[model samples]
Target chain A: MTLASPLAALGRPVLAALAALGRVAIYAGQTFGALFSKPFYTREFLSSLLHVGWLSLPVVGLTAIFTGGALALQIYAGGQRFSAEAVVPQIVAIGMVRELGPVLVGLMIAARVTSSIAAEIATMKVTEQIDALVTLSTNPLKYLTLPRVLAGTLTVPLLVAVGDIIGIMGGFLVATGQLGFNKATYIQNTLDFLEGADVVSSLVKGAVFGFIATLIGCYHGMASGRGAMGVGGATKTAVAAASVLILAANFLLTSVMFGS
Target chain B: MIELANVTKSFGSNHVLRGVNLIVPKGQSMVVIGGSGTGKSVLLKCVLGLVRPDQGLITLDGQDVAKAEREAFLARFGMLFQGGALFDSLKVWENVAFRLLRGPLKRPKAEARAIAIEKLRRVGLVPETADLFPAELSGGMQKRVGLARAIAAEPEIIFFDEPTTGLDPIMAGVINDLIREIVSEMGATAITITHDMTSVRAIADRVAMLHGGVIRWTGPVKEMDVTSDPYVQQFIHGRATGPIAAVR
Candidate 1:
């Protein structure tokens, strides 16, 4: 085999990936430009808010509550190794607000909202509804993508805020009812341990992660191939990409906010 | 009038269209006949500016289509997809009234609904059908809804892409007759792409046969039967052997 063959093989996928990224950037720019234009489609925007925000509450609440309970138990156990059991309330507050709250909400949205948006749009594309929109003098980006993206961007942070509160409440309930800690002391420790910066960073992460998830969903759906398999593949890729990007964005935002 | 001169398009190694030339005069129906994957749909999409030609001139009434204002350019045309491209999220009336409810054509909600119901009636659908989703309808009913939606804005030009596909013969004939009647009534310039000779005879004032990425033959529909062009003859007669292959 030629020495250049391996290098060429490696370069091919790298180039393809770069091209895909370029397409995604262009798509994002177009959606952003279309965001402020006239013909706002307010009905679609409200519907999207209901879909991406209101409907997502149940799953978000359940996930947050369970994670918080487990997290409190884990922190209690870990603190025992250092004879630092008293730190449970403080650590759970910081952990849920600064990390678990936003990340878990983001991932849940990736699984729930991202996959749903991708599948629905991809099916519309395969069935020519997008083309129909174009023929009707409607820009699909404005009619479809912008509303969902805006909903995700605006609502995910609120969802995360809710998650953080619920998560802290779950920890408080566990620490008081099960761990023999007084309720009032637990609440005070959690409140005093959480700073405005930590809460702000968590919400910021939520917004960024929301944008990534919905945008990825729309992009994949718009670029999907033809038929059922294409819709399936788009859903799979959107969820996977959104999840990874949310985690990566979380890390980057964390470093920026807390780095030395 | 709409005209395409020396149009060409390719996707990867597939040269779907090469140097196609044709014209459709205003107020006449033109049916383009070709087998599956012979680029009939691509050619229709080209005229709608949904697909750009690699090299060609497409003009609508002496203005270059490529340079026309997109909203205005698309405003003049309506299309019925092979599959009824109705928005599943919307009711039948909402799908029909989609163009009226937004953009420059915006109408009051009640007026749009009234127009939608009228258009639905024009296509022989019951007023009750207006409140239902497309999924609730049968295949034939969905096609009628698509037809109603296509003509909702009363566009100057209309396109039918395989309008008779995926229907029983009776339903197919019903759709063809409805299309013919609608085109005549609206006096809208119409272009249809299909392999069904029945549809061609029923709908076309003029006919063009596309094969091998080009227009092999075109003439008035009455002359199509007598045309000796091998490809046209083979296609019209549904022959097994001809200049066109049975397999790609």
Candidate 2:
């Protein structure tokens, strides 16, 4: 192969990546534009809120409780090596609120909500339901994408707040009941250790992650090819992309808020 | 009248419609016939503005369809998709009255439901079917519901894409008869795209045969059987050997 040929091959992928990014950016702009227009689908929005927020509670609760218990155990074990065993309550509180709670909840939503949105929309496309909506004089962006994205963005922070409390409670239970600590003292220390910034950062991250997850789901779905393979591939890509973006956003937010 | 002049469309290197020209006059049922992948559906989609042409003009009542106000332009037309295209998340009545429940035709819930039930009854569905989701209905029932939805808004123009596909022959006959009755009773301009000759005989006022990216033959349905055109004969007769090849 010629030198120019290899160079062209490398440049082709970069160009394709840029084109995909541009398409997503344009889709996002159109979605936001539709938000201000008439024909807002109130019923769809309320249904989406139920799916993205209220319906997700049990899964979020279970994940948070289990994670918080395990985190306390690990911190206690690690602390004993440095004569820092007594610091378990404080570290667990900070870790759950500042990092694990938001990140885990974001990942779960990606797995659950993002995949679901992608699959449903892709199926609609394959069946020509989106075109049906157009023929009905209803914009698909307004009726389908906007409500779900808005619900995710507005409700995830609430879920994150709820998750943080449940996770702290899990840690508190483990510390007080199984680790030979006074229940009242553990509760007081945990509450005293967390700052307002930690909670704020957690919620902010939750909102951003939610936006990325739902937007990626809608984008990949609308762009899906044809047939069963198309639906499967879109769901896989949506979940993967949402999860990675959430993690990357978490790192950036963490550094911005706490880096020295 | 809806008119297409030199309409052409292509996807990548595969040219679908090339210099397609046809006129569907007001208040007539025009059936377009062609083999699979002959761009019959694409022609319908182009008129609906669901698919834009690579080149050419489509006009409705002498106004360019591409430039018409979107909602108002769409409001004048309704379509029944090949797969029924019913929204699975919606109940049957809600699917029928989709346009009435929202957008420019917004109606109160009770009024919309009443209209939906009326439309459903028009298509021979019981009132109880109105409350059931699309998935709960059989394929034939789904198609009837789709027909109800298409006529729900009382549009002046209606397009049916493969209206009888994926149904038992008896059910297909029922759907074909329903389409014929509805189009005539409404006095609406109707365009139907299908390869099924039975559907063509049962539905068309005029028949047009699409072949090799163009209109090969078009005339009154009564004259279709006697047409000397080879493509029209081969397609209508389901011949394996003709001017058109059987295999891609």
Candidate 3:
């Protein structure tokens, strides 16, 4: 192909991507705009809390423990080269509280929560249920989206807090049992080394990532194109968009939280 | 009464509605007959505010539909979607009494259930059917349930989108008869979009033929076949050779 043709092909996709981003921004704005409106569906909000928060704990907990255990081992081995092996307890505590805990939980929520929300909404659209909602005098954004996004934003910080504690416990288990560190001393070291700012930043990251993951899911699902192919495409795009946005938000949040 | 004055809509370059104008008088059963993809569904959606028209005004009584308060306006009408569109998460009774159990029309659960069962009975469904989910029912049963839901609130207006689709001939006839009887019984203004000639004769007082994104001919159902308009005649007779092309 000629250079001009290649450049045009690249330009086309970039323009398409920019247009999609603009659409997503509008969808997100509409979703948030509905938040302060009257006739709030409290029943729907409680239901969303159970689905997006309570049902998600098992997967998040499992991922956290495994990650914490593996992180402790890696840190222990890597620090041995510098004859800094004893720093394992402090390093694992700081790492779990400040970074790995929230990031992993956010990713897991992106995988489990985002994909499901997108598929359900997209299927509803394909089946004309959204139109049915309109005909029923219920706003789809209020009835379907706002509750889930609110639930995600509110509960995920708690999930991250739980994840951080579980991860630190996992690290403590490995360090005390496998690494032959004193159990009491390891716990003491962890408590002493972790700062209040670390935990605060971790929870803040959780809330931001939660909002990003859920809003993207809601946007993709509601804006899904027509038919079966469209629903499948929407579900795929929701997960992809949510996962990318979570990571990007994690970076920005980290920079703002500690970069200064 | 509902009036459409030069309403138009287009998606990208594909123009779906083009300056179409029609009126449905109060308490009249108006059937819109058209081939698939002729914007029959789009027209109904436009009036319901599900799709925004690109131009012109749609008014109910004397006020513009789009400018009216949304929930109050929607409360005056009910729609039977082409696919039934029942909330799969809800049981049959819950789906039927959806309005009664929520929003401004909230009622006691027991009362709502009783009303749902009563409405189900009106549509020839058993009270036990109210407890079952929509997925457990056959297509004909689902259609009947959808009908029951539409009439449950005693809406002043009802729109039926392909009410007879995907059913056997006998079931289709049953649904058509029920739609006609219910519309008259409630003294409700009704609009139905269908291509089924049987449905047209059974449900409509007047029939309007939609073709090429515009109303080709509109008159009493008796005059539909006898109209001099080639497009309406060709459509009613299902002719292979006519001014209306077989392909888009």
Candidate 4:
């Protein structure tokens, strides 16, 4: 068989990507319009906060702690190569507070919460429950998407803050115990390196990531195709989209916050 | 009253509905019957504005349904889905009283639960089932719960989409009977879509046979057996070899 030209091989994938992007744009437009329309679901939003935020604390806390510990060790080893081991506590504290904590929490939520929301909503759409909601005079966007998005927006920053504190503590533990740094000095150094700007930047990143995660989940879920296979595909797509967007947004936010 | 005029819907190259027209007067039960993928459900969805018609006008009480104020228009309708789509996260009572518990019609939780339990009882469900999650209920029980929720808000128009698809014959009959009683008692206009002849006979005051993207025959239920339309005869008789191809 003769080999196809490079252009032909790339045509299908490019067209498919453009189609996907168009669909996403449509979903975003619908979601944004519905969010401001009548019959807002405040109770659903509060309940979703409890479900997505309060219930997610334990996992976020554990992940942050372990990540902080590992970062401290790695930073300590790397610093020694340049005779900069004295910078371990400060570097770990600044990194955890400004980047790792929020990014990690956002990725974790994309894996857990985004997948669950997408699967649940996609199943509802496939099974015609969303139609039922429409017949009952309830807007699915108001009833379903608003609550989850509101919950994500409000709760994610709090989770990130909690994660940041826990991570810094983890770094402190490693610095003081394993690396033979004086406990008080390590604590003081970490405190000195961490500024209000770092905390604010992390929270801002958390909010953006949270919005992207829930938006992707809701969009994919609402637009899912028919059957069990459709729901599964939507769940996978939602998580993947949310994770990638979170990382990209993290980089953009970091640049804006510190690159000047 | 609900009316669909020249409604057409298609998914890409597949045409699901082709200028279908139908009318159901106020408080009348209009059962739409057809084989699967014949656009029966799509017709009902078009009227409810769930699936927008490519070319058509849907009117409720002479107001264009497609352009009607959505929330007010929807408030007048209820629906029972094929799968009894109760929220798995909510208690049975909350699912039943979903509308009454929030929005402009918000009521006290206790009062909503009381109404939910009462509606559940009307459908032959026990009060104890109110606190249980949907997953804990049997298939028959879930259908009954769905019926309860459908009637909870006392909507003026109720749409039942395959309300008896998966239940046993006995249970299906029970649901059909319940649907008939509830629609009559509430004096609500009803539109039901089903392939089940039993549901057609039990719940429909007038039956409309949808085939080939349009209504093939429409008349009183008593006339269904005597219809000369080959499509109707083929469909109601479940004949594989007929004027209507079986491949669809």
Q: Whose TM-score is greatest here?
A: 1
Candidate 4 docking quality: incorrect, acceptable, medium or high = medium
Q: How high is the lDDT of residue B236 in model 3? A: 83
DockQ of candidate 2 (2 decimals): 0.95
Chain A only: give the TM-score of model 1: 0.97
Tens-digit lDDT track of model 4 for A92-206: 8889989999999999889888998899999999977788777766778888998898789889999999999999889888888899999989888888888999999989988
Q: Which DockQ value does candidate 1 get?
A: 0.92
DockQ per model, Cα: 0.92, 0.95, 0.84, 0.74
What candidate 1 gets wrong by more than 4 Å, as runs, is none
lDDT sort, best first:
1, 2, 3, 4
Query: What is the per-residue lDDT of model 3 for residues B50-80, given as tens digits with 9 covering 90 to 100?
Result: 9999998999998999999999999999999
| Native-to-model Cα distance after best TM-score fit, residue A4 in candidate 2, in Å | 4.2
Residue B95 lDDT, candidate 2, scale 0-100: 96
Compose the digit string of candidate 1's lDDT tens values, residues A121-193. 9999999999999999999999999999999999999999999999988888888889999998998888888
Off by over 4 Å in 2: A1-9
Q: Which ranges in model 4 have alpha carbons more than 4 Å from their true place?
A: A1-38
TM-scores for candidates 1 onward, in order: 0.99, 0.98, 0.96, 0.95
Q: Tell me the TM-score for chain B of model 4.
A: 0.98
Report the lDDT of model 1 for residue A168.
Answer: 89
